[model samples]
Target: MIIGIDLGTTNSLVSVWRDGQVELIPNALGDMLTPSVVGLDADGAVLVGLAARERLITHPQLTAAVFKRYMGSDRKTLLGSQAFRPEELSALVLKSLKADAERYLGEPVEEAVITVPAYFSDAQRKATKIAGQLAGLKVERLVNEPTAAALAYGLHQSEPESRFLVFDLGGGTFDISILELFEGVMEVRASAGDNFLGGEDFSEALIDGFIAAVGKQHGLTDKTADPAVYQNLRKQAEQAKRALTGAPTATMTVLHAGEPLSWTLSDGDFLKLCEPLLKRLREPIEKALRDSRLKAIDLDQVVLAGGATRKPLVRKLVAKLFGRMPAMNLNPDEVVARGAAVMAGLKARDVALSEVVMTDVCPYSLGIEVSEQLGPGRFQPGFYLPIIERNSVVPISREQIVSTIVDNQPALHVSIFQGESRLVKDNIFLGELILPVPPRPAGQISVAVRFTYDVNGLLEAEMTVAETGEKHRLLIEDNPGVLSPEQIEERLAALAKLKIHPRELLPNATLLARADRLYQQLLGEQRQWLAQETARFQAVLESQDEALILPARTELKQFLDEIEGDGWL
Candidate 1:
């Protein structure tokens, strides 16, 4: 049976189409929404959901939460002396959800339709798929969160034609999707969002404010340096954030140094602290509206989704921005999961979803990096040449031709990037490939590069040499953060070995090692230099352009040698 999974940042849910409607599957605790937290018990047994969430306060060092923010990055979170990638943590959540579905359905389910933020990049989308695979489920489709919400709403709408905006504010990410419904089709007009912004930021804002207001008085400088204290503060702030949804004021307190540091935050004070986050929210909304070529008045309704939208302040912001109270007929937290279940039903050819047709748009522009001719013999690199613009309907193929920049160039190297940036350096480097071309005078040889994007967010590039009649296809593999098929198998084996059964083995010392431990310890100039160099090196590695990465790696290695070799240490 095929099921729907909303593998969210703060919580996750599973649902399925049953008896002509979507039915949510409850976990072992009889809760539909499971906290997306994972950890290991003192006895080396794995714990997830509410059990793991509660441990965040008592055993902060053994638990990990909010790993979804690093979905497509190489960053690792340490959980009980073992380091895990974001996807690995996500897989544990998905695995638990899958078990819930199986127990509720009384059958084995192997296929799923997972929902992701519409603005999730290709790498992030791929990571979601990998997570599903790790959980023993074949991800049949990946529907965008907003698009899924629209699908669920579209199926129940009485009107045949209507346009609406989906305002999704979750725990660790935010997305704005504009969609239109006509006849029997639901179309996504545009999508925009900040991957790093969400309800967690508000909690963090409060934490920062509390520290600034009372840290020095209690001799609690850099409270976050203590994981237990930080976790306590975070939990308090989260509870306060939730309480403020219905109340005008909430008290936030954390126990530190055997004393209670308490602060009563009024709605006005909370708003003042989160003013920057609120302002940041507007940019994505404006961009989505502009990209759709529609004004706020053009929207028939603004639908809210995600748990964070339940906040009164956020709701007020939405109402103010659209000049209308947003619709919340469907529970904000459950709507996306319902929509994903509808997609699953559609995949299964269920009669309930037979009349609906959904279409999504590419959230970001996909293109290649090129060198622009500056003079007779000079050419400047790092310019982005777009092949497919953002918001274009997906399952699209777009091509653009370009000539060699230099005379007698043996081969043309094509670097693929994804973003709206005019400069390639500022964009996300997807992958690169070198196409062999006959050496000729500048602009004498041309190659047509065609980029094909599908509904799954998989991008394939085909470059054809005009003169040689040769074609090379780049499948965008071997990325540093994206695990390959072989790597996936290896990961699967490793996970099986660490299956969280009763064990007495000692923790591996190296599992707790961090690449930036020294950098975090350094002060001032040296710390700044390390950060800058590390970022520069990481960018080069992400580009996957060996020509640039090799030299940058060498330079960074030398710098690290100086820092680690006796100069600063």
Candidate 2:
């Protein structure tokens, strides 16, 4: 039997299609959403979900979470004596979800439909597939989270003509989507988002505010210098932010340098700290709406997903902008999982499904890097050739035919990119394709570069030499820097044999101390400015009764950014 999984940044959930109904499989905590955290134990065993997150307060260095944000990058997370790729870390979470599904079904689960962000790059999507493989599940298909949410919402609506927008603000990523429902088909007209922004940013905002308050109270001017204290304060501030979302005020108490310090934070103060982060969300929302050529008023209903969307301010903003109250009937945390389960059932042939064809658009433009002629003879640096514009429908393919400029050129090279930037260097390079051509006149040798985007939004670049008919195809799996199946097995085997430090004595204390010292230095008008912003942030933070440590933390981090640039003191 197949199950659906929503592998989110802050939380993970599993669902299954059973008895003609969709049901979410709860974790051991009896909660639908499982924290996407993993920690190393003293005996070298791996712990996931809430158990792992509980260790973050004291074992921050040994725990790794939110690695989903770095899915396609070369960023290596050091958990102790062993290092883990983002995919590998994600696989652990997937494995846990698989276990939950198996336990609920009373059988072994083999296949799943995992949901990803609409704007996830091809590399990131491929990496997510690999993680599923490592977790011992066959990834039948990768669906966009917003698309899944739409399927869940549309299943209940009998409206013949319906149009709505989906605003997903999860723990670590945000996406805005405009979808149309017609003739039993839910089509995504356009989608856009900032993969790096989400509820996590809000939590950081609160952390920075608490750090600043601590600095002023103790007269310690150089709070920013202490990483360890700052880390601890950030943790505490995140807790306080979550508390404020439900209560009128939250008290934060921490012992720094052997002295007990306490601060009272009103809900108003929490929202003020997060106002800046809130502003960044507006651009993506506006872009998605504009790209679909639909005004805010055009949307009949707006659906909000991700745990972070529970923030009262986010809902208020959507209502004020769209002139309609957003729908929250479906579980914000479980909607994607439920939708994924329905998709999994469809794929498994277990349900009598409708054609319900879904057409999605590419979030970013695809192009090739090419050198352009500056004037008569001089050539400027290479720039990108945008073959597939952003928001173009798929599964689609486009061809860009060009000829070799040099005489008797034996081979043609094509460099691919995914971004809206006109400059090649500004776009992300998705690897290259080289095809051999017959030795012919420079201008006569033509090469056809075909770019095909599959239903999963992954790109396949194939080049054919028109004269010779020689061809070459490249898949992201061919890249070793990004792990393939064999590489994942090898790394998993090696990880099993490696020795790692115990969670009790990781360098989290030192990092937290450094973070604290750095947090104390901003004072005078700097503190006043942040305080005013925090007041505005609290107005939003206090309005929500849901648990929101993640968003508050993000807000605090933004406040810290106002005082210091990337250059950490």
Candidate 3:
């Protein structure tokens, strides 16, 4: 009745426990991995997986892919008459997998255990759960993708005790996790990552290189002016990138804007293109190791997962960095799904494997925004007490005890954040809680702000006033409207209404090129200013402030104009 699913960014896989073994369910195409893409038919129907991906080359505007990166955010995609949230888009893929399972078993599949990235935020995790619900699945548990991979690997090896590192590099995200095995427990010590960085960057790098090669071969300037041409070239570049991993050189030939374009890239040249991205990956790996206080050599085995890890250069770099070769004996693409099945077996009590208890640590710190006494008659706002330190094991709970600063303050506002920054403005405000206290003297009202992080990384905060015995809970379920099912639907509707015909609906090529240039020109301080201004713009947009909109728009327009005048755009 229950299946294990690895809902990955580029591809998805499904597996189930059967006859004391884990078996992966292949789709109708007889492939273990399904591309996480969706296509809209002329009849307003949805097609998922490989069939949808095949349509991307010609019908790019009608297809949506790589949407997993926007799971927690407000981003949506419009496909013909339908608008889809990241979750809704993802449900199409999940639903397709569900149908495949049903077809194979000749029974309805209604329940599942889905795996998510280890560094996914609370909102992202909740969004994934919502996707499952939308697909008519009773999600028994949301397991961390790395932890699931560890479970599968541990079960496969039948090892007694070992500490292993899971390095996951998918299409649009990367996560490095350190997990330890003690007795029958597989505990995660630490996790770190850049959610925006992954194989997509490598693909971009390859595209850029191909652009240069095409320009040189044809003596044409501004090859990027044609979106269709660029898209075709990008596809060729991706193929070449993959081929160069095993071959000494790879050739790409494509017709761009009615012109014949051809190029050959060597493995050394391909590695050079991705060198910067490979360097960026080291930060997360080093951070994870440092947070766990374990050396790279201390790890018993380093396991690689995700399709991107198939790159020979990535493996070589990882080996050189760790002074050891990674364990690649297991299939990289299927390991996570296999692990999910093992976890399903353990949870169902269907297997005799030792009780594999997993305790994962929080990737980010939790704190509250409060006023700090700076000097005489002066107060500055900053992050106050930290409720959960990074790398603290879960399903753990902690609370910060604080009091009101003003006398007879009937209510106190608690602003929660998740980041290591000392400044309140630098961190993300997860949400807020308002607590009522009994009328009392200054600093007399004792309020406990409790934070609990479960195994899935979902955060729950509760405020309890001791004197009045008043309690308030801030569960994701409680904030229905702000984070509502209907709101998600509305967002999807809005996105659907908006036209995304890349050739006709998007901004002019010149304007888009200018925006990209301006984005790149932003320096250290200017980058921060841009972020603040964008946040302000988003707030104004959310508030629907008609009077403030024009002024804010003008400010942003002027900023863009200045950057253009400075020859940046």
Best lDDT among the predictions, by candidate number: 1
Candidate 1 off by > 4 Å: 500-569
TM-score of each: 0.87, 0.84, 0.82
- For all candidates in order, the CA lDDT equals 0.84, 0.76, 0.76
Clash pairs detected, candidate 1: none
- Residue range 387-435, candidate 1, lDDT tens digits: 9999999999999999997789999999999999999999999998988
For residue 31, model 1's alpha carbon misses the true position, in angstroms, by 0.4
Q: What is the C-alpha RMSD of each candidate to the true structure, in Å?
A: 15.0, 10.6, 15.1
Total residue pair clashes for candidate 1: 0
Taking all chains together, the TM-score of candidate 2 against the true structure is 0.84
Model 3, 1-569: lDDT tens digits are 78999999889999998778889998865678888988764444566775566455555677788899988776768776556778888877887788778877789989899998877777788888878877778888888787888888877666788999998888888888899997888888888888888777787787778768776667545545654455555556667767776789988666554466677888989889888898999999999999999998899999998888989998998899888999886798899999888877876778565466766678888778887777774667665568998889888899888888777888898988877788878876678888878878878998888998887677889888888788899874432212487765664554344322232211122232333333433457766766666667657757766677657756765675765342210
lDDT of 1: 0.84
**Model 1, position 452: C-alpha lDDT score:** 96
- Over 437-502, each residue of candidate 2 has an lDDT whose tens digit, in order, gives 778876798878888888887888888878778788876455434776677789767655644333
lDDT of 3: 0.76
User: Residue-pair clashes per candidate, as listed?
Assistant: 0, 64, 0
